[model samples]
Target: MASAPQQSLPLFYNDLQPLSSQQHADFKIRSADKAPFLAKQHAVPVTVEEFPLVQRFMPIVFSQGEEPVPLALMGLNEGINTFFDEDGSLNEPNFYVPAYIRRYPYLLARLRPDSDELSLCFDPTTDTVGAFEEGEALFVNGEPSETTKNILQFNEQFEQAGARTGQFMKELKELDLLIDGEVTIQPDGAAQPFVYRGFMMIDENKLNELRGDQLRKIVQNGMLPLIYAHLFSLGLMRDIFGRQLRQGKMPEPQLVQPTA
Candidate 1:
């Protein structure tokens, strides 16, 4: 089941500190080969811009809440990641990694609650960026280095994409196109199908029933393809469950009685 960040801090971040030359002039950011923080993170917030790429890799579902955010499911169950090994390394090298994961350790956040401005910030708890001798320099001669500029640019783009994602969600809600999501998978010789819930997805029935003008509006505005991408990705849920079973990460079968 997926939920939004419940703590004061966002997911995967312990604390956020503004990036500044005065405080971290000598800091360098080291490239990490493995993402230990993502080992147990089954669901990650994804932007609408990534729907096409995400659909090819994982099932895209919205979190269960009044303000549901789109999420990419790495595994059906909590603490299970089919794509990541126990050590946080990828199970396969060629798998498409989400932009949210790639944007880790750095993000643009508002320093004040009332401010419209956002500053580049990083997780100070991470070893990825610090006063390290080896790695890309964050600043050179009291000015931001090229590496820092690139990081800032990436985070900025992410923020823009995030805003677009929000608008997409707002439209979906306005049209009443979202519904509680459920999936049932039955392994060979199993007594009952494994029913998975606690997520939200597009109400395909509602989508199909929309007025022709409403349908045309979404298609013209590019929301239709994203919706189809999400629907198509649902089939990957079974594939993910199979991966978990093969990797020995599947939990003991919990059977549910069939409804009359």
Candidate 2:
């Protein structure tokens, strides 16, 4: 085992956190209100790790001030992407020479010492200590002896369905309305964009009859399905702040100890 990262500490998060909002009105090229909505969708009551962990508390988020933040649903993506540290073996350089090389031990001076003893000096890779961020490693189910292999059957299906839905919306919005993107704008002086989620709107019942409820059927079937496509007053705040570089865009990023 290697030493832990230095960044292990108590980090508390709150309802209102750092959200980037455009300070200047002139820089805004698109005259639409940013799509700003609390990502409460992921918190929809469901089973996790065969235990009711999330439902114990009512999940909620809101805009506290000028800044806008978006919370996305992690759902099964967290469990599915998880893997073990010792899952794969290391690839040593020039691992071993067959018996052919051992016969002629004079070829490599390193093997000369072992040939007399009928042994081989393959390699030693596990000597070096590994590094990881503090508190990033946790024993799932309090069982540290065994590591888990990520098996997200539903998570994979969820990702595929979300991709298809995004494409479908792009096409629909192009044909039905010449929307630059998902979010629309008010016909006012600013022409500010209104938060428009194609997945959220469109009346679920209407699509149920039209598409024969393929989307609805996915979620109802116990897959944390992509039922809504969020587009609202909240601009991609993380994009504005370049948080993807510092933090990350994906959900449940592997926790690692941050080092100086």
Which candidate comes out best when scored by TM-score?
A: 1
* Clash count list over all predictions: 0, 20
Query: Which lDDT value does model 1 have at 36?
Result: 91
Model 1 Cα lDDT, one tens digit per residue, 81-142: 88997788988776888888898888788776688888888888897899888999999999
Location of the lowest summed lDDT over 10 successive residues in candidate 1: 251-260
- Candidate 2: regions farther than 4 A off: 1-181, 185-206, 211-220, 223-260
RMSD of each: 5.2, 23.8
- For each candidate, give its TM-score against the true structure: 0.93, 0.19
Give the alpha carbon lDDT tens digit for every residue of 106-184 in model 2: 1111223345321111111111101223222213343321211111223334334435544544533332322222334
Cα lDDT for residue 129, candidate 1:
91
Model 1 whole-model lDDT (C-alpha atoms): 0.85
- Candidate 2's displacement at residue 108, Å, is 36
